[model samples]
Target: MGDEVPGVGAHARYVPGRFADQVALVTGGGSGIGAAVARQLAAEGCARVNVADQDMDNAESVAVAMGGTARHVDVADADAVDALVSGVTRDCGRLDVVVHAAGVDDPEAKAQLLSAREAGEPVDVLARLGDERWRRVMSVNLDGTFHVLRAAVRAMRPRGRGAVVTVGSSAAFDTLVGYPHYAASKAGVHALSQAVAKEAIAFGVRVNTVAPGPVDTAMAARTPAAVRAAMEAAGAIGYASAEDLADSICYLASPGAANVVGAVLLSNGGRFTV
Candidate 1:
């Protein structure tokens, strides 16, 4: 179309208004790709966008600026996820689309990996990465996705038509080196989305995922600058902005993607094509 439009946050980009009149709920809408997704949804003509995140302040900031509602939620908690979905449906009357952008990092992995290098200690990646770190990341990224998808299906089944887009990572298909937990969680996310798509299809709900490579986000900042630069040099298109990923997500949720079920729309800037 060779066109563009204003987005909600500093990270988003312009897009068409195919989403007009739809109601969307975006989890992890406080910042990064999630924030950008909420903004794109708003700019694309969503009548109401519920910005759900554990960080109420950021969620509120994004929601208020975009003329949508803010919600405090921990997607890892099944009950809380269900409640958020119910509340949005009860108040907004219907949820035409859902985008799950909530994912977590392994703080323990980062701290240990960085500290060992800083202290001149022999870096043992596995030794430093405890079981807790793995579980925590999986809980938030994989389990949380399951919870949100399940809840959304329950609500959408009654309506008999809906669309869902979950944000995943290119790391799932490649190596993330020191962050095995994060990689594993994202891999599970892709598998889970496909499984859910199969189940939800019978209910008229289509579920899919957008897997982006190293994008310019706080999460990417965790990588050592030297390593990031080296990786970028090897990549076909290097890193992309949050808006790029958001653009793909909005496309998947829009009517143009009505038949793109159980698919993973990879927006990795040509780094990983799978």
Candidate 2:
């Protein structure tokens, strides 16, 4: 893992031109692991990188920094996702890799959990999980991955070679008692990735999922202190940086993972054996 991939990105094993002449698209590239992945792809000499995100400002900033293009896309909108993949393919002439990382946590649910913890109140997490909150999480986290993966697979299948890495969550398997919706959505993403990989592999398109634990991202920053502490205590290496998760993601998207398909690569730094 420490080996250098020079052209791929910083802090990675150096393999000059590992991604040269390739075209890649990273959803949620506005920040966190997605942003790191975009930068890595650019460093690896990808001919074109499309940064798709709901946050226009963040997306633009990352794209400009990496010398890539920014696209304002909400993966929940299947039509919009389709157009994004089509537009990228049309412009780049081919799509070599895709990293679907756009996802959301229910703010209401998180807020309730935090408030309850601070107040020492007994809060029923499930009862507070309203229909709207649950739906929103599912739409953005699960359906969004579906839209991106569907479009990406279609765009790459004809070419007979491509790699797709879906960013999932360790919560999916470990179970986040306070955020069932978030966990369920990510679980769906993992299952979907495997299902798609089963068919996409025949076309030479590999699909995989990366389930990351407590990384230093905005989402994790807002976690309850108690929960964060517990998670860190469980992990052998404590919290991982966004770049650390990006390394795992980029490796899966690289040729180094050509034989890896439908595998959920857990990157929790030895947190929770199960």
**Top-scoring candidate (TM-score):** 2
lDDT of each: 0.85, 0.87
Number of clashes recorded per candidate: 1, 10
Please report the candidate that would top lDDT against the real structure: 2
In the order shown, the candidates' Cα RMSDs to the true structure are 2.7, 2.6
- Tell me the tens digit of each residue's lDDT in model 2 across 1-274: 2333332335644345678899999999998889888877787668898999999999999998768999989999999999999999999999999999888887677677777778889766898678998999999999999999999999998889999999999989888668889999999999999999999999999999999988988878777787678778978999998888877998898888888989999999998765
Tell me how candidate 1 scores on lDDT: 0.85
Each model's TM-score, in the order given?
0.91, 0.93
lDDT of 2 at 232: 87
